[model samples]
Target chain A: MIAADGGLGIVATQRAVLTENGPLVLASGAQLPHVEVAYETYGALSPSRDNAVFVCHALTGDAHAAGWHEGARRPGWWDNLIGPGRAVDTDRYFVIAANLLGGCSGTTGPLSIDPATGRPYGADFPALDMADFVSAHRGLLDHLGVDRLHAAVGGSLGGMQVLEWALQEPDRIDRAVLVAASSRLTTENIAFSAVARAAILEDPDFRDGRYFEHGVTPRHGLKVARMMAHITYVSELSLAEKFGHRRDTAGHDKRLAADFEVEHYLQHQGESFLDRFDALSYLHLTRPMDYFDPFGAHQGVVPSTRFELISFDTDWRFPTAHSVRIRDQLAARGAAVEHAELTSPWGHDSFLLEPDGYHDRVRAFLS
Target chain B: MIAADGGLGIVATQRAVLTENGPLVLASGAQLPHVEVAYETYGALSPSRDNAVFVCHALTGDAHAAGWHEGARRPGWWDNLIGPGRAVDTDRYFVIAANLLGGCSGTTGPLSIDPATGRPYGADFPALDMADFVSAHRGLLDHLGVDRLHAAVGGSLGGMQVLEWALQEPDRIDRAVLVAASSRLTTENIAFSAVARAAILEDPDFRDGRYFEHGVTPRHGLKVARMMAHITYVSELSLAEKFGHRRDTAGHDKRLAADFEVEHYLQHQGESFLDRFDALSYLHLTRPMDYFDPFGAHQGVVPSTRFELISFDTDWRFPTAHSVRIRDQLAARGAAVEHAELTSPWGHDSFLLEPDGYHDRVRAFLS
Candidate 1:
């Protein structure tokens, strides 16, 4: 493993491969002969391994949750929430962040080679759900020989996994934090995802997710999809504040080029996203999020784990109502639950921004 | 002209071409040698030619405002609110609906042949504004020999034109109805439009707006654009009610297909739009809407015309706050203004959907 610092001191991403044991069964009834999970850890595990905390990431996120990778300009996605004295305080908690099963990082995903065919899985990768992701996390836990976790934390789709952890293995998790995430995807949420997936599929270069073999990426389609999703990720107030009516002088020709500051911002966002994300993984990962329904039939068997649910006031994607619902459901089943709806113009992205208030609340709860 | 009945009696779309009458200058300082406006009319003109009610259509609308075309499945966009006894009644007024200058119907637009090259204008279509649309309407009025209008009414982009008409020719428009619109596009509004336009531009087939010559339409790009715009046109509540978690059994294989009802609806909307609309024309019309700011420098010169501004409470696109701003501005200048923010779940499209309350207000105000 290589270590680097992004102001968070030394941290490194490590890999763990599980093979030669037995085929891992997936939620879709498919099996993978072997799997590799890319994970990063901060601080040291306690002698009993009870102080370890696991952090799951949202779509497009990777195992690099904190600190900088070697030669990388930017730190991990959740660097703001982790570190010496940050919300998830690596000073005290042994934090473990791993790329999801269908992510495009070093994790096993559509880009992974199929041992049977000696080729990349591509569209041949089996469908996965939140349960499958939880199972994969279990594999990482087993590899580390961690019998119990002090806490599990996540936001957005990550939050879904946190809830799933509590539900699927109540005895292994002591605390779970879900931020800006719903118990299940809403119709509007599914609609947005559907459109995003369609955008990628319609790209000619996509070639039924076989673009990797053709040496071409569905850049335009993926960018368009990202642009659409980006709109849902931010609040109207944030967009208005950042790029309201600001015209781009160079685009005054009035053709199809971006004329408004918002257009330029969206274009930049779309283009930058293509550099880090995989189109097939985006399609695969988003499916589980749309199908998430952890508390649907298991309402009567709610876990008694401590729960802290946070939501942003301006988050229309997963509104505060979703958090409130989860809190209420857990409370109804005699679970200790704390819910907070913070005010922020960043909307759903507030989970990754406005760290002061969020960190304070998180720190106080965790402690 | 060919007549057809949509339960409100006979109506037909008529075309008027203006050539050899000098160039029509545009707000962008560009000029067209000739232009064509497609229009439809109902009822008879008063003896004094003073009972003319000119109705402007929104972004996707054309001349067919209140009637059925021969062999068409649906009536004009505003059929519910414009009939013999409905709002803006044709019983006592001559109602006129004209396709904007840069529209797809029978009007001159990007799809029209450039007189200079005998080729379609495509991306070369000059930028237009609400002022240009109003001017084109004026040409139609002049051709019809209508000296003045009893009222000029519109909604959304159409509402922008109504406001512009009142500001540009106050004496010619006695009453103005503006629905679900604002004096200028908000920053968030521009952001949505920017994304929509970028989707079309990113399509490989778009070919820098030269797709018409390549024998291929930017179907994917246009569909993606339409899908994004369709989301803004309706409300979250509406989407939830109509397609909440309504999964498609056929799409269970889950390889970038329509898995939810909303996705299917959006796909249909995008596909149908391609048949009736031109992508370049969409780009042309949306720009003027974003640039419209009639009250920017003329705050003190508010038209003294009687104004009826209607908005929907659920419309996030152009919420009631926008209408309130316009009303306050007009009222501050002592203009006669009636404002109503009706409740609806249809969002911005409420103007065309729920007709009872809207029609009552329009009928009473027009009378």
Candidate 2:
């Protein structure tokens, strides 16, 4: 929450009980007894609450989507795209970004205490699906007395959640903007995630997700997992352009230090992630994306929700083909959808960055 | 060294002194007092010893390129590409396959005993370069009384060695075929290898590469490393075709069991690697490839050796672009060079299989 001495410019995080009811029933027939969502907002809500734009954060993201936090070194994660005079101008639209369900960033997730056992759910955390993620997102909106959404903008896994929320609440969402998202995961995609899961699950310190009580975490396995994932997040061209040929690697440096520039960059990414992310949260978030098959039955339709899907040219993670497929599926189901494959060297991470035309396109769609 | 049980029908593995000279000096200035190579020869060497063709192995490969090991369940790794009348026809040319230096498969590597201490070298094994691999390969040829090679063929890492050998000894090699090979590793390529190295090095059982005394190996790290590599070795399309979709995964299966079909396949690939590979050997072998820059100085030339570089359409590991670059380089250096981007359902592993028009192209090139 914004401190009592809250300043005018710096935005602090706020928490709210997502649901007014007792327990939230998940799509998997599981029940979350208590669900609290952490959120950050910018600008003012319209008198009718019709200008509320819900922004869904991607995997590993928190409610701090924009604006500088008090005493912080830098602004929020997407501070580049969502601020005053920015493409996602806070002056025009009231933006609401929340920590999604099954997240460790203040949302009631695996790290949250179980009311019955009075212990962190840990391995006992129930399985979650896209609908469950959407449910939590909508619950936060309900608590704020918002009846409809002006738009829902998300990227990567966040994009998946937006798609789910838009599809389920067709009439409530006017514009559903999905950036570098997938309607389903491919065998290769699952294979990559499987390796990450193996690294964490097989770690000796993991102790079967109950590592919290042991005062140690699966840092090694999680680090490897993050390093591998970071490689996929950025394109080959971007990595080369960012850090060109570094020839400092030793042939038999049994220690395997961060010899190459790219290795050093990846090592930092992996190391820093351990401080903010929980192994269980990672497992919870990524697994749902692997099994996400919204168009499996071709029943996913959103007639009232005009869809705007943007994909990066270099994004092999969820390539333009994935956007094309999503477009085709939505169009076939009689939903209005527009898609674009933008140029960027940052691969799957292009959506997060202000890649040339990316911000402009999103702004144009929002307006 | 082929045992008495070896019959005329089955080509059994044989061991020979790679170098008769005292301590073969390596490119890195490190010397090995005794070096032995495990090799297998198919067909007969013609008089004048001019019909000899060298076959180099890729990462995790060995001397068993073709034919069956006495009681083995399967033929060699590249059995389909070599044999009596396969593309690498053993009948027309005497095909010799040898495990490369720093290899764990019956070659003097990290697991080999040090002459001075009489203990496994482990981490003490000297560093290696492409030139060193070529030295060992040439030594094997000298032992067989073969002065010049009719051709040298390899895929992936093996293909890199062939390039180095052809450049160093242009006149000695008549033909050099490099399939799915890279002349130099890109930043992204090295990043992947770096993650693999991290997984193996940070393994608890690694013990600074002296795990031999502990009677334990870095199996967990090695398994994770292999799993990640296995994903890159195959294409997204191929993986999708092989394993469509099996969605039995539980989000919080905290155990991270092989619930998905692809997960099961990857798990099998990772687990099976531990049985045939060594951790230090994996680290040593992969690191050199990251630093291989034969064309960096641009003095590399192979005037007499006709070069044939083949790349698969789906092989993203070392895509057709890698072959095109190599082709342009060799052609500019006054060398006879040709390259083809072949169609294959498989990725980098396509070299070991008989894809449509693949075997025919090789046979015609060899003839």
Candidate 3:
């Protein structure tokens, strides 16, 4: 595990997955080479390296999974869910949380330099996929001398990777947990993602995705997309309960003034996210999530793959029905599988929120 | 009733009860003087004038309620629910479906010329409320020499105005039918409306709301707003059943190529709406709906107002819960009220779809 330092926290700089003929060509007609994956490790790696668990992050998630960074008051992204005695149980297993390949956090992504142009990939960053992301995670595992993982757990986009890893390297993954994950991108999902991408692309400061050097960013566009995305992450009942006609939201820092507490919460979530995330990275990640199709490559190849799938009832983004498709397919293949839809008002983001009884199910399933 | 012409059928123009001081000042601060409401009359008017029924339209809805429009093949927005012997039967009762006061469909709205400035009010048009809308409807009724209405039925924003009319002029309207309507804007609802407004305001072509003269309307903003609104109009289950992950929607004339079927539907709906609606009027009508609060205005005032509310099970926008609130409020006020949530997958637009058995309830309630 990397040691915590300064405000930036522990930066893992050891993993270098670069190859001689590297910077592979991407679907967007761009090349990425000299890739580096900065990731964090939790718990101790067993002698067989079979106790390792990989935690895939969502669209806005980072590599940080638990513990506090130096000078930072907050813990990791899944701090509550992946703590000493939490669901992921870092104390009981070695956990790896790596920044995705097309991320702006610590890994090599859009902000990383292109060797050929000697500049950041920016808009030129090659369009990516679940394969590229999982490959990068594999690269990190190779560097760490870990050949296989005991389990892969993820939610939303992270859940996509879990499914990808389970299919891509079936023998390498022992157990897979997919939460509110879809097997393929539906038309509505793709449309929403397209709108989000268009929002950033239309921003004047976007600079055709070169906004970083231009001293301007498509903050407004990013914020709008984030706001839109936030709506899909929650349920109407929760929104009604939280915000319901309370329109006092005036000036900044006023929480209760929300016309609907849900709107205020979403607006705040969107605006705050824009500040920390790179628009291009956001575009890269969301598109892949939309294009994801676990059935495409695998086809009828592995009908009987072991799987455990869970979804929240109120999650409309990737509803419970989506999870059922996976379970059904796996069952058709005669694979060992179980599926459950937890009663939750947290919607698509339920996996992150530590609502009562949710973690209990996670622990029970993983146990 | 003014006869339907040029693709608009069975239209009626009424100078219903006009206030001497009206064209009242709108939210845009422009006064709409000598207001004229273009409506369509269906069924027969009882000798007592107590059988007159008024049906209001949504933001982009037109006055033509039932039957075919001249020069056009399609029927009115609510044609599915209204016809010669439909729910609100034209043969048995005099039905009035009018273009709202602030609408662009042959009514006095932002698109109308401000005689004072010799230009369309555009964005300069003052916002409106259910009060202003009902007043305009009242004016049209007065001109028809109707002292009372048997019932007022409307859905969405139109339903909102129905609620307002029942409360504001309780004596004028004895029965009210609100479908998928809310008494007050939820924060989430207002926030979504705010996002739509911001989109319109952000467009450079909007030109401070004076795009009509410059021939540069904020089509993109309007389209985006409409797209956003469309998401709320349909149910998730309906979307899954209709579009799902199907990629079969591809053709030159079909919208499938744009993205997901849902997105294509939204884009088409939004784009088509911009052609017939005024951007400013969208704002004007939406704001009033957002601020429509029966209890806020007349707390403990009209609790005894008898009302009938109906909602569809799939109408997520104005879900059955919203109707229940109206019923609960009316009941709390000791007003005779009944409400039902029809099992339909049409979402908030079901009021126009006329699901099976819906007309029977309406007939029983009115009779």
Candidate 4:
């Protein structure tokens, strides 16, 4: 357990060897010789083992969905919606969040040492599928000895994971919540992710993803990609409200660098991101999202699980239309599904934020 | 005149040294020691000199506004709207199109030599403003010995230039048409440009904007920037209509490169841009647009030039709100102004395309 200052915002990430059977096979037929899952759990497991709830995180997020670390400045990414009495209500339900496959957090990813070569997988890491992420999550569940989950919840990429799992094991999850997710990435969405990947791959320092040998990383490329993604994550209105045309510099310094407040803010976001994220991880994780076509491939295999799909009005990344499409497809597949387009000034990041009627809706549904 | 084959599409670009008295003063209090303007003309000059219309080129455009150059496959940019019988109606009006001050074309830009150092201006190039573009344009007019114009027309950045010139020289232009333009860039807009600029500046080959001296340029950075900008230039609807989620590669290559048709399209845009555009010029030109707050600085000043502002319904970059703001500002200043939002599948690039009800509106206003 993380040493909590006042028994609040304290959580510890734990690890367990999950692949008991011979090499875990991916959706693409590739196999991982060994798999170690990193996960953080909140609250106690019910005596019936039926009160377990799983949480999936978006791109750039880790297993730390809620609670604060021993020396952290702020709570976990989704601390607002998954605490003692929050939407998920840790007091009554056992909640689990794991670092996804191809992630750079505690989970085994591209940065993990290959048992065969005794080296980081890096560029040699096999292609990932949405099903592969679900497979890893199941491994964690099997290790935890949870037969069934009361509910599963995720947003953005996390939501994609939740969707793939719910579809793969319809009988395991009784209820599922997918927020600001997509059944299929649009051409524009694919284009944005492609450019971000290109930025990292084309960086001179990338060195074919073996930058560890050179004691350097593709910091510039990764920073640029982060800055670009940040622009798309937030709505124009939110940015205008936050930064506007306000320049931080006095007079007309007129340098070609960050002069406007928004520029500096983006630069900070980009620079700070370099500390935690690996370029290879960014490429690997975002690629699966580009190719995620659940409804396309699983048209006939419909899930029996009930679903609540949520979207944000200002989310241009994966707007309400994306949820509506998911709803329609699930409805067409003879599945019971509910959808809501919530009002929010934030864009795609609205799921992580407590927008009007957002937390309340999630809370009411989860209960 | 350009030598024409079948007289179908032919035009020649011409050059003139415009500043006769002294060095041209920039809006930022800096001055260029020398100034030369590249211009192209269509239609015969009226004997009364009252039928001249000036066309301003947007970012990455040259003085080649219309007609085909010898051995070129495609006509000059804006060929649809400025031909002999198009919207501007070159047959009835003598049209003059000039490259902007910081452009990479025939006009003096960062690629131009700093007369003092006997080397390319590069990073040493003085700062630019919307007013500086207007000043250089005025010099072009002085050299042509044309005191007044029937109209001044431009779209996007070109539109911004037209608006600045109209305000600076109110009596000189009878009518001004601004298309998909912004008087002031929003924070989101500046953030985009800032990231684009950072890509070039941070590229290993940039060499502090003196990549020319190193016999290398920021090709990767500039290409990335162009690819990013192209995404904004078109609407998501148009991208969907044009490319959809069509995968171009055979089967599941599953590589991190361009898989979707839109990625290849964006890749082509980025690669082709490297052939014609200079990195320094890209930085210089885009910077001015970020700092373009004409209304903020020139609030007391108002133009008598009749204004016709056109915006595309789908232009998210500088949407109809931008044009509405321009109209409201001009109207508040007691100027005759008209605003219209035209339907177009294209986004910001709609101004350059023959969208429905667009050319007709401009032709009517110009005539």
- Scored against the true structure, residue A344 in model 2 reaches a CA lDDT of 89
lDDT of 1 by residue, B1-367 (tens): 2233434655679999865488788866788888988999888899999899999999999999987777778888998888877777888889999999988999988989999999999888888877889889998999899988999999999999999889888888999999998897887788778777887877889888889999998888888888888888888888999988777653224444676778889889989999988889888888888778888735567586899999998898899999999998888878899899898889999999863487889999999
Tens-digit per-residue lDDT, B146-215, candidate 2: 9999999999999999998988888899999999999889899999999999998898889988998998
- DockQ scores of all models, one per candidate: 0.60, 0.54, 0.26, 0.75
Question: Cα deviation in Å at residue A210, candidate 4?
Answer: 1.6
Candidate rank order under DockQ? 4, 1, 2, 3
lDDT over C-alpha atoms for residue B69 of model 3: 57
The CA lDDT at B313 in model 2 is 97
Q: For each candidate, what is the lDDT? A: 0.85, 0.86, 0.73, 0.88
Worst 10-residue lDDT window for candidate 1 chain A reads A1-10
The superposed Cα distance between candidate 2 and the true structure at residue B321, in angstroms, equals: 0.9
Candidate 1 docking quality: incorrect, acceptable, medium or high? medium
lDDT of 1 at A8: 74
- Which candidate wins on TM-score? 4
Sliding window of 10 residues with minimal summed lDDT for model 4 chain A:
A1-10
Q: Model 3 lDDT vs. the true structure?
A: 0.73
Compared with the true structure, what per-residue lDDT tens digits does model 3 show for residues A49-106?
A: 7788898988888888776765566778777677566687766778889888889888
